[model samples]
Target: MEKPSDNSGFVDSLEKLLQLCEELGQQIDEIGACLYPPQEISSIEAALEKIRNIIDVLRGMQWFLRLMRLGGLQGASDAFLEACNGLRSSLRELASEISSSNTADIEARVENITLTDK
Candidate 1:
């Protein structure tokens, strides 16, 4: 099995997850630029879903890290646990919003929504 990056793997995972979220945000911004109605809800939602999945993976990793840290001086810190919970809650809310959007034509709109390297 592939071992985790470090004892603080959760922190590293958080950094990676945040980077992906930022990239997704940029994609949404670009998609919003050319689309009429100025709303690419479905594309935004697909990005959000990816972010949510990353957050979920990080949550599970944090749980394992917490278990490992049980006997250490730096046991699962409140800030770390709080962040995990917040990420989970945020992802859940984003998912709910995505589910409620009446979005379609994502594939057909791909040419319009794609961002040029400018």
Candidate 2:
């Protein structure tokens, strides 16, 4: 029978998960800077491309986290798993917003509606 790996690998995976989370935050912040503080069109486009790449890596990290939890040295804590799931949800929301066309136009239209309602 093959011997199972020890907690060392599990600990390493946890570290990786933490690192990925930090990177994800940085990616989101970059996107915010591009959109907010309203930069040039070219800068926003470049930041968007970077966000897409980060998203691809984040997807892989999710898979890695799930696999580690399933075949881990020990079962991961509920809190840990929940936090990871939350991050995944946030990613989905971000994806939807970014994937939508004419976001600024839509925002402007919505603001006008709100003003009229007042």
lDDT of each: 0.57, 0.56
* Candidate 1 RMSD computed on C-alpha atoms after optimal superposition onto the true structure: 9.4
TM-scores for all candidates: the values are 0.44, 0.46
Error of 1 at 38 (Å): 0.9
Could you tell me the lDDT of residue 14 within candidate 2? 67
Give lDDT tens digits, candidate 2, residues 1-118. 3434766665666677678668767766775565552333455455556655655565556555566557762355445555545655655654555456466753453344321210
| Steric overlap count per candidate | 0, 0
Screening candidate 1 with a backbone cut-off below 3 angstroms (N, C-alpha, C), the clashing residue pairs are none
Candidate 2: deviation at residue 68, Å?
Answer: 4.6
Q: TM-score of predicted model 1?
A: 0.44
